[model samples]
Target: MNIEKFDSRFEILPIKEIIDENPTTKTFVFEYPLGGKPGQFIMMWIPGVDEKPMSVAFDDGKEFWVTVCKVGPASEALHLMKVGDLVGVRGPLGTHYNWGNGDHLALVAGGYGAAPMYFVAREAVKRGCKVEFFIGARSKDLLLYVDKISKLEGVNLHISTNDGSEGRQGFVTVLLDEVLAEGNCDVVFTCGPEVMMKAVGEVADKHNVASYMSMEKYMKCGIGVCGQCAVDDTGELVCKQGPVMDWKYLKKLPEMGKYHRDAQGTKHYF
Candidate 1:
């Protein structure tokens, strides 16, 4: 939970603004530094609703935002929230992705995974790194932040969708092959569904490029107190050791891409 920097307690803050990014997703802006790294997440509390771990889509030292997609009950509640409403926020938790200065970065994201990868690309450009950004979703309307990414000077943007609504057709990993083949990418950072991230890791391994992936699980506690987010074999807590993990760490997890646990700790295979 980045315990040294943030405590387990929730800090209540008003929704400074909300911007609809797509039909299914909206960005909630809060006027706080958050002090989150590119791949860090926060547990958001909604009083009677629930608190869910979400990625920090943007954090500019002064304010931060999280992009919420209406996928379930908790997310739906977030979508229903309006400006000036107060919401509880916890740590900018978990380990974050890392890269060297001026390195060429390969950033791949799927669906709402584009949110944090956008943060990665933005920060990378600021460090003078050349970025090759690949964003994927089900269709054109589902793709997030492509316009803003295109405007970034050092970024070369690419898009892919499952139904070919825009850009190339098929999985975003298909485009990763081309970017890695160029032999300029220093590392690959990806997020989204576990299966997609597993595939991204495999591609990175094939190219012998280092890779880091963001993972999600059904967790009751954003802190390590609840073991719900622990992975197979090593028992590394996703709420602590990860949310972001390199291929070396993730490849050892027996359940990677195969199954995940529900809130009740029942295994659900993909």
Candidate 2:
């Protein structure tokens, strides 16, 4: 679809509900019927604060949710706001994770990436796909969606933390590698930090499992018009062509896990 559609335009809506996921993170709910799919994101505008891309955690015809971690200015401002505060939403844009083609799914998440991955897992299990979810965080306190993900049936949850506060003490990738070694997964799905996604993508590629990754990049216009989010070498615009792409295409982009551009095209290495 193109950006000329009405849904691509911003609709200011008040926060209907807010659920605290952690001390520093909360999920904002709105009553809009976005009908968005997993891996697509919404550009959330926090009044005076700039609009930023956010993964749509859940959307079920009547209400939509966005789980935000208080990391940047826009998110910090959002955390300070209360219920009924107005915010602009203009998305469910970008590509979504692949489905229906696989029976057993492996989902990997890191930090706030857990939200988007949970969105996918919810749909995956519903489609009769057995899911193995791997969640990684610096510590238990920093993790997102552990309780919510655990409660879902047909999902085998695996967790890793650097501090050993919750699960195994190591990179979450280690858990994924171990699972892949056992050889039952049909596809791999992931969303999180670029570095972790890169490693996960490599693992999926190694196991010869088809993988879909929800990518992240600095963006302005959610459509392809903006040149701000183009991938180096390949020149694929993250906002238009991706945010979720297959491993075959993702491996072609030289900037996958290395660095990203800012609003002004400044390179920031990850």
Candidate 3:
């Protein structure tokens, strides 16, 4: 795959701090010039290993951040990067949430899904929209960013863990359903495993609320030219056309609940 368009690079900024989210997950905050939107992602390069897409966990222009769970080669390399170490970054790519039209916005996140949604919630608050966040993880150790997210204004935070280690003892979607049943949401946004997003989409559909979701797929090139990240029915190139898609339209995709192969050709089922 040709990755010329993905060649743009940012200086490797030193990591300022690392906060452990779980045994396998950590939030890395770095110093860098930033211009990213919520739901957008950055292509990170780990010196001789590989480059992968990561969502912006938080950013204040002068300082940028990402929450990475050590799941693979790229992520493990990211975990090894420490204070004052340089790491390559390239992008703020993909579409961001349009909080302009909504009055009450609800955000649903699962596991590392909270990374991108964190920025969305912050931006929504900045735009004067009331934001409610529902976050889920397999266990308490996997949940992250509670302290930081709690500080944002107008955010109603809800959490769930499968192991019942924190907050509610069920899935985050349960809380989402409850919130929707109360009929206070104008729009909904989500990012997580495809299955979780699909479930969230179903609830949003039932409530007739406009919804958007960030799709995660193996992306070799961050631009649209490569067909590596195509969506099921639409064949939409996620690199250029998405990562963020309207839930209503995404439901029409043929691969929604099926299976997809990872970068190393490992099959992952929804």
Residue 17: error of model 1 in Å? 0.5
Which of the numbered candidates is closest to the native, going by highest lDDT? 1
Total backbone clashes of candidate 1, pairs 3 or more residues apart or in separate chains: 0
RMSD of each: 2.1, 1.9, 3.0
TM-score of each: 0.97, 0.95, 0.92
lDDT of every model, 2 decimals: 0.92, 0.90, 0.85
Higher-TM-score candidate among 2 and 3? 2
Global local distance difference test of model 2? 0.90
lDDT of 1: 0.92
Across residues 138-232, which tens digit of lDDT does each residue of candidate 3 receive?
98888877877899999999999998999999888899999999999999999898888999999999989989999888898786766778777
lDDT of predicted model 3: 0.85
Superposed model 2: Cα runs more than 4 Å off: 1-7
lDDT ranking from best to worst?
A: 1, 2, 3
